[model samples]
Target: MFINSKGYYIPTKRVDNNYFAKLNDLSEDWYFKRTGILTRARASEEETINYMSIKAVENAIKNLPYDIHEVDLIVFASYTPNDTVGTTAHIIQKEFNINNAKAFYISSACSSAINGMEIINSFFKSKISSKALLICADRNSSYSDDRDTQSGHLWGDAAVALFFSSEPIRPNEASILDINTLGLGNVGHGPQAVTMEPKNGLHMPYGKDVFTHACVYLARLTDTIIKKNGYSISDLTYFIGHQANKRILNNVCHELGLAENKSLSNVEELGNTGCASAPLVFAQNYDIFKEGDLVCLSVFGGGYSCGTCLIKFN
Candidate 1:
């Protein structure tokens, strides 16, 4: 599969560390030192998951070389869907009048976007669809507890839209080289590490465990995918890890012998935007990617699942 175009939408409301300080008595200096997060994007009442995704598609469609009607598959990868029955994918299909596309939703925590793309790749491989659209968004504020000291300051809201085709459709597009995904539900704290319950809200009782295992799996996935494709760490032009924490990203970079500048990050500004994190980074930095550049996206989500995708600009 090849990437045709990408677009993203981040909420305008910026929540700083002081908000957490006032709400949870966590000092700005302490928070910044621990998480390297100064401010995060928070969505307003109007910026629901559907709204943000629609806006992102609008932005992405502007750069699309083909017509919107060419899309035959629409996948909305989000754990924070506003309505389970009427999902964002269906909404996008309806909004764009893509009456011929198959639409649905999927969730594997933060790794949902990569998994969704993998599904699209499979569909293309099976001759089921030639063109696909992936919309990933997360409204963490909808389920986050502002008073919870553990993760109150770590949530953010954003959305990204990515267009894909089974074959190279345009010049300067990215070609999907390989995709590897793993479900580590039996590893470490697993499901108990991070919880987002309706009654309890989002909490990380085992944040330390999450951080430890995330660093390991993210690095392992990236290393495996790159090596499986016969490339070395130094050959990777850019690395985009799951935007859960700065420390975790640093740990993965260190483990992979990757330099600081080579690793792209958005957690510092967007906090953890759940499934939207990695793709949002790609969309925001799409113009910087040159032809022949090798990019790797590795992600570890709350369900203890991890995945990696290798793409090279063609």
Candidate 2:
């Protein structure tokens, strides 16, 4: 499938490291040295997951190549659901008045977006849909506790919208060359590394374990995807890893022998945006991607999942 249009919405409220420092009694440098984040975006009461998602879709569809009614599939990929029963996907479908579309929600932690995209790929390959909309978003602030020192400061709110078609709708669109995803429920700390209980809020009991495993799996997925596609690391024009941490992404670049200059990220400014991280970076830098450029999106998420997507800009 070809990604025809992309857009994102990052809340305007900025929460700096000092805010966390005061709340957790940790120095600002300690937070930055560990996570490589200076500030993060926090959504307001009005900026719900569904609201941010719709705003992102509006930004993406500004230059839409097809009618909204033609979109046969709508997927909302997020772990922080506004309403589990009435999914954000259905909200979007109804808001846009999409008359004939199948809407659903899926989540695999931060890897939700990649998994959603893979499902869309299958739908197209099976001739189940010609046009699709994938909205990946997270309202991390809703679940995180500012007083918790471990993972409370690692989250930021954001959303991204990606429009896909079975065939290229425009010459400048990017083609999905290949996608690879894995469920690592038994790897490293597994499901115990991160947990979000309704009463306990979001907490990371195994921060060190997550960093170690994320570095390994993200690089592995990126390298495996590139090599299996008969391409070398040198051919990659850009590398966008999961925006969980700048340190993790930098380590992945080092392991893959990819230059840090070619690695693009917003984690330093936006912090970790959950499932919206990688795609948000893509949408933010969409204008700079040149024709024939090879871009790789590698991600690792809390459910102990990792995935990679190789795209070729046309």
Candidate 3:
């Protein structure tokens, strides 16, 4: 599978680190340095998940050669769905009048989009579908709790869409080389690592523990995939991890002996858009890679699920 095109929808509203610094009574430098976030986009009341998803897909295909009818499937990834009964993917299908395609959702939190890509690759290879649109979107601003300032400061709202095909859609594109996902539930850290209550809708995460765990596990997962695929750390041109925080990515790179510049990080401006973080950062930084460049896409999410993808630019 290869990406033919990518589309991104950034929300209109912006919240700078200063906003959180003042709210949490921390120095501006402290929050910005620790989180590596300067500003984060926020969704307004009018910006629903489905709306952003469709708009992103529209943006993805707008410059491409294919018509809307050619898209046979859509995989929507998000944890911030507005309605439980209404599926965002199916809604996008209807919005684009993709009459023949089937749509669905994935709720693996920050890993949803990466996981969706893995699934779509298999679907294409199996001939279950072709020319699929993968959209990773989140409206995290809607779920922010006034008391949970940590999470409030870390998450933002945005969506990313990508056009994927089994056949080479473009002469210049990144082919899906390999994807490996693993679920290490809770990891004995209990539910305190990350949890969202269904009753009051609060996102509670233990900062220190989550920080330590994320850095260690993400590095291990990336290393595992790299070796399992017979590729070494030096073989990867760019390492794109979940843009959860600048500190985490930096630490992971340091552990791998990988240069910080080789890793694509957009957390400074975009904050962590959950599952949308990695793909949005990847698309935005795609031009930095040379043809045939090796890239590794890795992500660790709330469920203690982590994955890595090895890709070769086409």
Candidate 4:
């Protein structure tokens, strides 16, 4: 699908590393040394997941040439839900006053946006819809315990929206060429490493293991997509990864011989927004890429999931 436009919303309350360090009883530098996150934003009570998501889509539709009511489908992605029953996609659709559009939600952890795009790609290829909307939102601050040291300081609130068309709405629009994904779920392997308990309903992720897997697997997944698509490593112009960890992204770029400038990230300043990370990065950086430039997106997170998509700018 051709990307017509995108919109991003990051919470206004910015918390610095010092804030997390004090809570963890560690030095400020320790936050950087380990997670590489310096600051992150937290959503206010008024800025609920659906609120931010609707705001994001408002900006997206405003920027695009299409009407909101004309959108044929909506795919929503989120890891942190504000409720137990209602799907956020349906909420967004109803708020948009769109009754005819088909909508669904995916909670595929951090790789959710990529998975959403994959579904959009298929719809375009199958000629099922001419226009679609994809929204990824995460309000991780709601679920994370502020007093906990491990998973507490590692999340940010964010929402990103993308409008897609089967054909380019503009001559210079960027479009996804392919999406490759991997899900390794052994009987006891994946979710055990990163989980939210039913008893306490708190996020509990094994940081070191997640970091190790993120670096190696994201690198491999990215490389595999590039090569399989007949694009040389030298052909990639930008790498927008999931805002999981700055260190993991850096290591992946280093392994691929990619320069620092070629890799774009917000993890240091925005923490990890789970599913919204990659799309938010893309919405912010897509204009920097020149026509015909090949850009790659790679994301890894819980469910032991990793996904990569290669996009071509026209």
lDDT for each candidate structure: 0.92, 0.94, 0.82, 0.84
In the range 29-74, model 2's lDDT, one tens digit per residue, is 9999999999999999999999999999999999888888899999
TM-score of each: 0.99, 0.99, 0.94, 0.96
Instruction: Mark the 10 consecutive residues where model 3 has the least summed lDDT.
Output: 184-193
Kindly list the per-residue Cα lDDT of model 4 for residues 56-141, writing each as its tens digit. 98888778887888899899988787765677888988887976888988777899888888888888789887889999999988
Model 3: lDDT of residue 139: 87
In candidate 4, stretches whose alpha carbon ends up further than 4 angstroms from where it belongs are: none
| Model 2 poorest ten-residue lDDT run | 196-205
Please write out the lDDT profile of model 3 over residues 1-314, one tens digit for every residue.
88788898988788887787777787779778778888888888888887888788888887766787899888888888877667888888878788889788887767788789888988998999988988899888777763466677888889999988898865777788788877767474535567766765637467777677779877998898889888899988889999889999999999999999898888888888888988888878767778879888898887667777888887
Best by lDDT: 2
Alpha-carbon error at 158 in model 1, in Å?
0.3
RMSD of each: 0.8, 0.7, 1.7, 1.6
Clash pairs, model 4 backbone: none
The residue ranges of model 3 lying beyond 4 angstroms of the native Cα positions read 190-192
Query: Mind sharing the TM-score for model 2?
Result: 0.99
RMSD from true fold, candidate 1:
0.8
As a whole number from 0 to 100, the lDDT of residue 20 in candidate 2 is 86
